[model samples]
Target chain A: MRRSRTALFVLVLALAVAACGGTASLKGAVRNPPLEVGTLSLPGPDGREVTMKAEPGGLLLVYFGYTSCPDVCPTTMADISEALTELHPDQAEKVTVAMVTVDPERDTLERLDDYLGHFFSRRLPLRTEDFDRLSAVTAAFGVQWEIEEHEPGDQAYDVAHTALTYVVDDTGTVRVEWPFGFSSEDMAADLAALLEEPRA
Target chain B: MKRTSCRRRLAIASVLVVTLAACGGGSGGLEVTEAWARTSPAMAEAGAAYMQITNGGGADDALVGVSVDPAVARSAEIHETVMAEADDEATHGSDMGGGMMEMRAVDRLEIPAGETVSLEPGGYHIMLLDLASPLEEGSTVELTLTFENAGELVVTAEVRATGP
Candidate 1:
């Protein structure tokens, strides 16, 4: 009887270890920065108001730029799109991309949808809304933007804004921000790590 | 012999006048100010760039073409944005000019002197073709501008992020 009891204890110890290992939390860091997001009502291409709200619900990856931007916006957006493409189907499903146009004058709902669509071939939808809400999102996330005045009457007039990407988790707290100009591999690794972390 | 010498001097004076006008030196007012350009990131095969070419000189100047590192770009073309001919003002036409915007390469641009001919966003711009890599911010791209009169103007363009 003593030998049997000892064997039973050993079995329980092994089972316990296995259970703890399955629940090991990933070491993903969330931003401790304060956030400031306000509601905005920008018109979509369909002529509908694409209202944006500060939802701490699902994961949010936010960036601020115009569709007319030539270099950095496309690069950043392309990198994100490629990283999303590389993720396993399950991992890809959980992530969401949100773009805000500082130049709402041009990056209308229609334009944002169209611009992001080019970069994102996947059916995974990207959310875009008005400048105010977008500005609020950036402000809350500590993103910076300045209106760049070019020659008058030039529609190509663009805004010089920050090339930063923010990651917000299910709990709606800004978890991390990746600056502009990240290689596809680095972005993929960072995103994968975030996905593996335990739910907050 | 004295009369012959006078004729020779007159011919020389005519040549000097022609040279001065053609070269645009000291009088033609080849003014270039606020000139800028941009390149895409990740070494795009083709990218659009912009600049402001302000000629304070009281005459007109033309930007014929631009030359950067030949190894980096095959050729840099001057481009202007025009409404996509097929574009309709209404409907959910998601497809417009494919791959960014359609940049019609411009062979020449007339910058009226005494006016700031700004080639900024939404205006005339220099398109940098096929980059070796993305134009990293703080990295300056060497550009050589050839004018109709000013010959070649060598300038360094600071590569910065669109919104940084």
Candidate 2:
């Protein structure tokens, strides 16, 4: 009976270790396991195909916005730029910031390039081939966007999109998501912590 | 003797008060402060300006219209960026799922008596549309804001690369 009880205790200890090793908890970040976003191929600012995969051995920071965004989009980009600036040069290089435009009709490749150039250099301006493709890619990350039309005679319109910044690990699993008003310091700290985690 | 000195002191104090009032006091007048605009890319067709307007007098004021140089833009108007209600199903873990964001033109923005109206990002702003040329950073644009009670106030807005 004593030997059986000892064996059961050892089994419980082993199970607990396995469970703890399966997931890594990040500060100020939501742990989302099994969140897989497969490889994405989109047009880069250079008009060439840019395929984004998790095997690149760096974290991917993806944000969705348009070039004509007068406020939130620019603010978020600036925040990301500042956050990257706070990181060490090598650590900053380990992270990639990709901005996917929802307003494909208005945000041409050249225009997207111009807008992103104002904030940071090491970034990707992902342009959609078409509306359908854009929808498919955004749906994979649970992003939602809509184009709000103006009055019947007016020619102006606005694209309303989700403003969250998704952080995906090197293995294609989403690890953290920063909401609209998240600070640069928090993002920098989170990225640093994620960088320290051992690769799976 | 003491009474005479007190009278002189009162006279000097009254003069100082009058001078200070003349320098800054505007009863019921609209004051514009911290006016600024974000720089637009060379190909951008529109830009936005933000500012704070305060009514210093006892009466309320309304921002009626905004006018800029014809060379800067074809027209300028007041616009409010609001987040409209989003679909229930789409609201799951979505930052913007709570509302559908949109910018709409408004006729006027009201400033209550002795109250301040802030025109900032994700809120009220002056939309400069049909830009003749892109607004460059480090440049300043002249804006003419017409108020219902404060008349027209001309303010120079510095073009910035980022929002506050």
Candidate 3:
């Protein structure tokens, strides 16, 4: 069963790459299955074990990047913030942005906290302990991470992963993930449409 | 005498047109307005600032550089976010980048007139290098934006409090 699942993941990953302009492959490869968003236990930047569950009552936007990421991570979130500004203050309430770290090795609770601070004044930190854990969760949603190469035993790296930001609907299903470089207007429109999805 | 007078007027008119065109967006003649800046915390070795670059006057204006309290930071520069890639097109990180995927600059940071320029995290931003001291929240830092032609405009950046 595991071999078949791995083969399927490989196939999907190949296709995903094709659809993604044949960008670089995702590191810490996982089984790219549709994520079943639900309660999961993970340590947050606060160092406390945080049990986060999917609330179908609202829309969640998720991304996987490390804190030290020079640009891609921050730029993507900043874009999301801009799109949020376009949303009605009331409707914005129904949206939550979740960024999980791939470099949990260095993204200590303190580091994660500091990293998230640049994005959301109130954004809580999301961190994982093991690569396998991150791999499993990210794979479940087809999130890829291919950390760039460097020196031997070196931790610092530049990563190339799926640039698409994930938008999970209230039902815990991966909804549409707006590709990188979506205009602010288009992002707002898609988000509004998703927000108005018959509130489950 | 008449010919010389006409040439002088034409030169003056040309200068005016060029200046006016630049006073807005690019030479493209876009209207610009609603410019604001966020102040970095003073005393901090480094800080960041943000603003809204509305192009009500033009199509778009690209922010290339900034000048701030030299006393506050050794240098102020513009930064655009981008993902790294390798020459073989693999992800470059701690182990890769045999000069492979170099971190490329963002195509452009568009400042559309009337739209707020949110240079927050995960977006276009100004990096303040070498701060004089730590910037405190609620404090304001004076920022001067030198545009291509619209000239230079100084703004106050408001520092917000956050966990260190």
Highest lDDT among the candidates is held by which one? Answer: 2
**iRMS per model in Å:** 13.2, 3.9, 8.4
- DockQ for every model, please: 0.05, 0.20, 0.09
- Candidate 2 lDDT over B1-164, as tens digits, reads 11236776575456445634654544336678889888876777778898988888787878887878879988788988776565555332243223345677899799898888999877899988878898888889899786765655678899986555
Query: Which residue pairs clash within candidate 2?
Result: B28-B57, B84-B100
Whichever of 1 and 2 has more TM-score, that candidate is 2
Candidate order by TM-score, decreasing, is 2, 3, 1
Model 3 C-alpha lDDT per residue in residues A1-200, reported as the tens digit of each score: 99999999999997775554221222211123544655454666546764444454666777777655544555566677777788998777777777787766656766666655655553556777776676666655555566655776665454555556666665665555566656556677776766665442
lDDT tens per residue, model 1, B11-123: 54564466467755453455454444443534234455555566666557787867677665655767664323322321111221121222355788887767666565544
Estimate, for each residue in A1-200, the C-alpha lDDT of model 2 and write its tens digit: 99999999999987875565433454444643445765766788657776554436688888888887766676678678888989998888888788898877778877887877777777788987587777767767777787665666454677777877888776666777787757889889888877765554
How many Å off is the CA of B11 in candidate 3? 37
Which segments of model 3 are wrong by more than 4 Å? A1-41, A45-53, A146-159, B1-164
Per-residue lDDT tens digits of candidate 3, residues B1-164? 11236776575456546655665534343332322233332222345555556555544565544667766556565664444343333322232111211233333456665554656443555655666665555666676555544445555666643211
lDDT (0 to 1) per candidate: 0.56, 0.74, 0.55
**Taking the tens digit of each residue's C-alpha lDDT, what string does model 1 give over A1-200?**
99999999999997875544322332323343423233433444445554333333345577766665664566678678777878887777777777766766555455566566655542222334444555455555555554445666655454556666766655554555666556667667766776775443
**For model 1, what is the error of residue A140's alpha carbon versus the real structure, in angstroms, after optimal superposition?**
1.4
TM-score, cand. 1:
0.47
